[model samples]
Target: MARMVFCRKFQQEMEGLDVPPMPGAKGQELFDSVSKQAWQEWLNHQTMLINEKHLNMMDLTARAYLNEQRDKFFAGDAIDSVEGYVPPSE
Candidate 1:
């Protein structure tokens, strides 16, 4: 049987992740509060930001920026968007 959590993002009970997506307290918080679906959504948005910004993960500053954005996103803050990015039309 799948684990269920009261997903903070979806505001409903849904399938939870198999494990914490990260280490430490934040990861525990997510494991406790965020649903797998919501985490996947954040991942998609994160990918867009990385691609559009040409973020270099090797650079500490870039990593820090991404981390900050991730936290803000999960916390429902207005995170910055990829500048000049236009979604493909179906």
Candidate 2:
């Protein structure tokens, strides 16, 4: 059976990641509290933010912004959106 966690983002018990997404305490925290579905959603949103804002991952400010956004995302707070971008019709 897959590991399960009480997802901070979704506020429900769900399937968890197989391993920590990164090293150290923060990664461990996420592994314990975040679900796989929420993590994947955040990754997709982060990628959209990077592409839409033309953010450079090598830049400290950009990384810091992403970190802030990530925290807000997991906390169920409002996050920055890609301005002037529209989703495709299904």
Candidate 3:
């Protein structure tokens, strides 16, 4: 059976990640509180932000912006949307 955690983002118990998503305290915090589904969603959103904004991952400012956005995302705060982008129809 998969591990369960009280997902901080969704505010309910959900399937947890098998391991930390990254190293250090932040990763451990996520492992303890973030659901796998939420993590995946964040990754998708992050990718869109990278592509649409043309952010350079190697740039410190770009990385910092992403980190801030990530925090806001998990906290349920309003985040910037990809300008001129639309979702696909079913």
Candidate 4:
């Protein structure tokens, strides 16, 4: 599971971050530009589904959302801890 920090500003949202511009903002570094784009698209779909379900507890819901999406990526081996907030390791 993962979480979206409430502290994150609107412009800092990861909406376009899956594949950050080269030499620009780095995101999803594990995936190349093309791969990251595809992954982000898939992530959007999953996020839509999660939002549709409507969760009252955002933290728990976000974590589950990320984990669920991770399953679709690497057999669920992607361990992005959305349970806490931290700057991107990159």
Query: What are the lDDT scores of the predictions, listed in order?
Result: 0.91, 0.96, 0.95, 0.42
Backbone clash numbers for all candidates listed: 0, 0, 0, 4
Residue 48 lDDT, candidate 1, scale 0-100: 92
Total clashes in model 3, counting residue pairs 3 or more apart in sequence or in different chains = 0
Q: What TM-scores do the predictions have?
A: 0.87, 0.97, 0.97, 0.34
Runs in model 1 deviating more than 4 A are none
- 30: Cα error in model 2, Å: 0.6
Clashing pairs in model 3? none
Q: Which scores better on lDDT, 2 or 4? A: 2
- Candidate 1 TM-score, true structure as reference: 0.87
Ranking by lDDT: 2, 3, 1, 4
The local lDDT score (0 to 100) that residue 20 gets in candidate 1 is: 99
Return the top candidate by lDDT.
2
Candidate 1 per-residue lDDT, tens place, 1-90, comes to: 999999887789999999999999989999999889999999999999889999998999998998999888877888998899888999
Ten-residue region with minimum lDDT total, candidate 4 = 4-13
Judge candidate 2 against the unseen true structure and give its global Cα lDDT, from 0 to 1: 0.96
Please tell me which model should have the higher lDDT, number 1 or number 2.
2
